[model samples]
Target: MPAIIYVPFGVYIVTDTVEIPVSSRVIGQAWPQIMATGSKFVDPLKPRVAVRVGLPGQVGVVKIQNMIITVKGATAGAIMMEWNIHESGQGSAGLWDTHFRVGGAAGTDLTVKDCPKLSGKVNPNCVAASLMLHLTPDSSSYFKNV
Candidate 1:
């Protein structure tokens, strides 16, 4: 089974973090957006991400497509995609046609981490191809999209 979150095309100002579980997806209708409400933050640990997904040990197919995430405050990264160790040999994940921007002076564009027993390089930012990840034991993931 696949998990999905759908947002219609529009502008939305938010002040909370958007977390995605294993096998979950976030879809945008045309130009759906997720933006922050504030312009700054007092605490650094507070998340400023418009969308977040997955954990270090959750293995499944997670997708974020056709969505725009904007950061209005200086907090966490715009989007975070995490990968974990998988022995099931049947897992895939991707981010398609997704865009991120920072309205504030501080913030990261994106962060991709392979933790809890995974190694190698993960290239998820490119303009030519989409990001594709397979969570298998002793496997590496390489993504290129532009």
Candidate 2:
């Protein structure tokens, strides 16, 4: 049997697509968001918040930055990752509206492809992920804004 992890609480994030570096290039991708999450352990662990399902299309990455969140206590403690200190976005359709999770914490990781589609249609291409992660020491991680 597997360890039954539960995300009894969650925040909401929404975003749109725009241009990058004065050029018109849309960001559309299919990747499982690996948010820098912390778990209860002497040595830090990336306890996968195995979201048996995934986020919805209506939910964008922008909203994730300002989501009101609450964390359920893990073995360590109540850990929450802020979206204000990192860069993140939806792999597709962002209105130059990318953002970083001020704080990053452990949660779910999955794409529309990994879960059931709430849009009544199931197209792999239409699937994308919105992840919140920690920015590197260098600021070169973010996408150049136009």
Best by lDDT: 1
Estimated TM-score for each candidate: 0.55, 0.20
Q: Runs in model 1 with CA error above 4 Å?
A: 39-42, 45-50, 73-91, 104-146
In model 2, where is the ten-residue run with the lowest total lDDT?
14-23
In the range 75-140, model 1's lDDT, one tens digit per residue, is 332332224423234325566787655432233232222111243543323111111222334433
RMSD of each: 11.8, 18.1
State residue 84's C-alpha deviation in candidate 1, in Å. 6.8
- Tens-digit lDDT string for candidate 2 (37-134): 23331112432221111122122222111113222222122122211212234332222323332222344323333344577775433222222222
TM-score of 1: 0.55
lDDT of 2: 0.25
Best by TM-score: 1
Model 1 scores worst on lDDT over the 10 consecutive residues at: 125-134
lDDT of each: 0.47, 0.25
